[model samples]
Target chain A: MRPLFVSGLCIASALGAGLEESFAALRNGTSGLRPNDFEPFPHPTWIGRVDGLESAPVTGALARFDCRNNRLAQLALAQDGFEQAVARARERHGAARIAVLLGTTTSGILETELAYRRSAETERLLAARDYAATHGMFSLAEFVRARLGLEGPAATVSNACASSAKVFAQAARLIEAGICDAAVVGGVDSLCLTTLYGFRSLELLSAEPCRPCDERRDGLSIGEAGGFALLEKAPGAKAAAALLGYGESSDGYHMSSPHPGGAGALLAMSDALARAGVRPGEVDYVNLHGTGTPANDRAEDAAVHALFGAATPASSTKGWTGHTLGAAGIVEAAISVLCLERGFLPGTLNTGRPDPALRSRVVLESEQRPLSRVLSNSFGFGGNNCSLLFGRAG
Target chain B: MMRVFLHGVGVVGPGLENWAACREVVSGRAPWGEAALRVPVPAMLPLTERRRCNAASRLALAAAEDAIGAGDWPAVGLATVFASADGDGAVTHALCQSFAAREPEVSPTQFHNSVHNAPAGYWGIATRSARPSTSLAADQDSFAAGLFEAALQATLEPGPVLLVAFDLPLPHPLALMRPRRHGLAVALLLGREPRGGALAALALRLEPEAMASPLPPALEALGDNPTARALPLLALLARGEQGEVRLGAVGARQLVARCEQ
Candidate 1:
């Protein structure tokens, strides 16, 4: 498999809107999760939410696509000049040659929720023509495609948590298949009541800031974020960390809970390493899916320990940015690249005591280590799992 | 170039139920059937699991089972690509209604089924497949998007891949915006190597949509549903005709599947 370099990237999470801000928060052991402050939801749970989405409205011709999700995407696209980087890619690869693949679980479904409420209150449906355009599942991708003026293949992957991580694999395949030379890949999921109460209804929301790998870890702290990266064939444009390989699998066990034995997780991790032609011993760090849910943490701990043993430093960045649902993949992928560039591994931010029974080494504090290879895991509902291997570009 | 052998096909919609039954109607050999909006469940799924699956999931699973049953292919290692324009609208509407109430409360089952990949998850659970699956959306171009994704995936793996594209109507206020949706599920079993039930070879390319005659009235009516974008692709596979149809966006970049048999 050929490598795709993430030449350009930007992230807007609860940690702040820039690379330096995120790096500083990670290096300083600062957390982004806090108690329930976001309004509109009755659930009393902590969350990681970005700022300005509620007060800031997306202006310009793209105004009709305005929503919490699209606003986050627009803001992230403008940060760190990611849109400019995409503009350059448009020139290098031709506007028609660059593809846009994003991921999200609820793409402006909040707008629908709001619309339904308004209709229920007023006894009539809104006649706006762009309601479907702004609220459909593909709305975010279409908005991003138009924002970047990309004419190549564009689609949104919605496989829950594994969504964006799988986009990296798809970009490689599409490029390797001669479909496109460059792709703008990422995900955006803004905080919404649907996610808040939906997870609450499922009893998967943590009442406190998430404590990943903690002995008493309970459930996840939901979050909202938007992140994107430009992937190009290696020799054309190089970055410190490049995507070496990715492996994907489904559990065949349960819809929500992972296979207790981590069967799918092991398959995904092993597949990624095998495809990358790297031994497990060579991986310096791992970013676990570690949603803080007891079932997920234990299952992932078993999978990681089995593959890399207790050597590689591993932690869940979800403690920093609450699990962003579909956006978790890209957000964590960018963080993995940052780990290789910064030459340090991030630790679980809010965890105090790591589970003793788990054989994997769950780092509690950030460590400055010369890291080369990193593996990021994203497992979604319905047992879908993807493991991505990232490394220095030689 | 991407080439996949269409080993088997499955489809379920209004009046048309299974592959063998739907084939006759799609190829213009029989009258198109009509039934109520309720999705029918075949015996492939057990009662316990079937009861848990929503209409959208059941529709997708039924179509997938039709293909798997017809191809007689092992489902254990199959890769799945589930594409839908809109996810489970019934569940989503229920959630919205719940939220609108004085107290917002969505059922746990509804919450889990709300994820777009719920159908694919059920597919994995029912088939006991440990293989990977992707769920995606491309609006009106979902059929083409799923085909593109599936063809690319099949090119890399040795085993056959499952491509299931489905959509159900949006309820009420949401329905007014997307007024054309109907319950429809279409499945295709694609493989690079020949299998026993292999039907025809297909090569897919993205190109400008060609000016051509509109489909017959009956087939054109099927286009009201987003998943019916596969109507032309189905015609090619079912009739053993060497042809290509425009997919994806109507005027923008489109997927053209040329039957190379």
Candidate 2:
């Protein structure tokens, strides 16, 4: 895999609007987790909702595509001058030579839910005008491409949680294949009824702020977020990090549940390490895909323990962002890059006590540290697993 | 830089069941009629896994089975790419209705099967293949995207790649809003080297496509369903012709497949 340099990146998550806000929150050990305000759920659970997005309008021709998900994408793109960065990339690669790949689970499904309720009363589906276009899985990527004025190759990955992370690899392949010179790869998933209730049906939504790796952690705190990174074939002089390598594997054990032994996770981690040419001893830190679910954390611990043992500093940042579903990959990837750039090991916030049986050193406290290489893991439903390695260029 | 050979092809569309049947219809030898719009359940799936599959999953798996045939489908290291314009519309519709219910307790089965990769997951379980798989959506242009990803895997990975693109019309409320009209799926088994069951060879290059020849009405109907967007290329491959047919758009360009017998 050639070095696909990340030229610019931004995220609008529960942590806040831009890179500075998110970085500052992480640096100060602040948890973005808050009590639920999303309607129609009876159970008391924590959520990582991005605020003021309802009024975060998409202007001009892109207005018809507006939904919570696309709005979040717009918010994130506006932050950190990501939209401006894209303009420069378009100038560099020519707008037609860039690709757009995004990931999302419930993309604009909320609009459909609203439409469904209206149609159920009217007995007509025409009320949901753009439902046919936006509700489909590819809507976000199409909307983002239009918003950024990119005409290159485009697609949306919706492999549950690993969606966005896998886009990085996809972008790398297309560029390496010479199909494109640069790409905007990321994911967006906004809050919707399907996920809030769906996770509850699976009994996987924590009632409290998610405490990843905590012994008493019950389930994940769902979050909505959008994020992006501009990956170019050549690194700009100011480029801080590059997508070193990525490993993908499937559990094949269960559709919803992970492999109890973390077999797939281990395979992905090893493959990513081998691909990145980084050794276990060299990884400065690992951002675990700790959803705070008992089975997920324990299984991931087994895999992490097998690779890095109890030595490498590791933590699950889900505590801050909740589990952003499809956006988890890019959000955490951005955070991992931030960790490499900012020089710190982010602690597993809100955890009272780390799991006693885990062998890996779970970072329960924020600490300053020099870092070179970091591995961020994202595991999704259907046992889809992806491990991404990020590092500073030599 | 590399010429990828197509080992096997599978297809399930309105009136055709597999590549052999699809070839007959696309070659103008058989009457191309309106689709029954009914996708048969994939017999390759185990009984336990059957209940977990929806129309889209069945459509995808059935096409994958046709492409795989009696040859070996390695249970390991086979990367799968599943693409769809509309993913699990049935589940989306059901989930939406559930939200309307007084007590919205989504069935665990529906919830798990709702992922866009549901068919891909079932593919892993049915074949006992724990290899990596990705599910992507490109709306109307999914076939081109799926082919691009599959070809990339074929060139990069050591193992053979399976590419399945499928989609199905949603039940009312949603379908009335955005009607797909037909349920369809197609598959291609690709590898760097042709194996025993190899069908035809092809060199796929990516470039901007000028509107070449207009599609015949029968084939034009195929375009309405995203998976069926591969019909033009499929016609060329099935004819065993050594000519080029545009595989539609990818990035800023289209996939120009030069098929060879």
Candidate 3:
């Protein structure tokens, strides 16, 4: 299948909003993880939290849908001339011809949780509109679509960590199937008490900044991020990354852990390579599914080793961005595009020693090199995994 | 475009535990009964590990078990895809509670279970298969999105893929947003069969069809029990209901399901 070019991309994450900041952080090996400072938590854990969300005000019609998640979305959408790109899309393809698809895990429930606990004593229940806006997982997508004045198909993709990456596949299909001419796709997840405590309870939160593929890697650092990309069917577009191919799979082995040998991960990677019509040797870089968890790193290591042999140069950016959960795929996809565009591979910050199993294959520190095609992988619970291949547009 | 087929399906719900049980309910041999209140099997992870998993993981595991049991589990390079409207809300609520308490110590188990991919990770460890898996959450149309993702996986990857959709009632104050009594999980085995089974091609189309007024009672019944929609759709398919069956919001953007004869 021919690749669907990514015409424009923008991002808002803890590292700093906009493609320029994020790319600069990646190039400089900056760690976005920091000690929890927003809401008090029992243990001191690292998180990639967007600053100043509480004070960020929403104006115009978007005011009605204001929340931490929406605020993050607003910040991300403002990056990289994204607003101008959308306007151009509307002018070229009409507002009704473009669709909006967003991927998120929690949506606006973080605000809803706050509302439920902090409402004034006079308040009996949450305001109906606030409740409706923050309750559904589709709220974020709807907010983006409404704010952009887009009338085409607008839907939310929520497949855990794979949510946003899968949106690329869906948007491409919609355009190919004649559902729309162009689409805005990305993901957003904001820091909330639920996500913080939930991972803590699960024992997946790292006490320090995460060390992906490190032998001493303990677990992941939670992070919040919002990212968007303008996808179009046309192949030639300025400053765009092409969606070469994507592979998805499910190994119904367990509910929480991955297959010991990375079976599903292997399938997803091989499938992606097949779809992109590129051999494993043709790939320049790999964005790993390195959550920094012991089990995840081991499994993904085995999978990457099995397919690309011990020669592939790969690194997990989680150490820099923390695991963004549902937004991980899109965030990393944007980074991979940036890597291809900049002709360099971002270093895996905080990874001092590579896991012995991945010693030869894994790239621990950042390196600058010419690269044409890059692969990004995101695996989620229930053994769900997806791999996407991106290439420079001709 | 490849023609996707629903070769086999396995479901685990409150009243319907397996295909046989599902068949009984669909055939009216037994009452459709109340939703499966909780998971039926023992936690695959030890108590130490299990403590970290949330309700979504429990239901997802059970549903995957039923789906895998319907076919060869260890042989095929199956890609597992799980979908829900709220991914791990119970765990999310617990996390918030801990944060609100301002406690100095957080449970490691709780943190692990909080990742959206916890269930998938657990499934991978238990199965000892290294196949890839994905988890997805979309509001009302999660089931459709899961189905679409699974079909896309089946087309892209070799061998079969399992698609599981599961969601449990929200915890406490969060539940007030969309209240429901039970949790539901459904899994489908999608593959490329040589000849047998009915093939359904799913496509998203923009049509002028009016949004079905008030939504059909059967569909509305699904509000409280989102997983149940799979049963009716599967039952209809098992009975050889051919052609596209659209399942999603009605408007400028809807998920179009077209099952061809």
Winner by lDDT: 2
Taking the tens digit of each residue's C-alpha lDDT, what string does model 2 give over A42-151?
Answer: 98999999999888777688878877888899899999988888898898888888999999988888878866656446345445467635677888988988888998
Q: Going through the candidates in order, what is chain B's TM-score?
A: 0.92, 0.93, 0.81
Model 3 superposed RMSD (Cα): 4.5
Flag regions of model 2 displaced more than 4 Å. Answer: A119-128, B35-38, B210-216
Error of 3 at B11 (Å): 5.4
Each candidate's TM vs. the true structure?
A: 0.97, 0.97, 0.82
Give residue B44's lDDT in candidate 1 (0 to 100): 59
> How far does residue B91 in candidate 3 sit from its true spot (Å)?
4.2
Which prediction has the highest DockQ against the true structure? 2
Better of 1 and 2 by lDDT: 2
CA shift at A161, candidate 3, in angstroms?
Answer: 3.5
lDDT by residue (B123-239, candidate 1, tens digit) is 888888888899999887888889888988999865778999998877776676777545888999898887774688888777765432244356665676778888876766667
Instruction: Give the alpha carbon lDDT tens digit for every residue of A252-335 in model 1.
Output: 888789999898999999999988999999999999999999999999999998998899889999999999998999999989
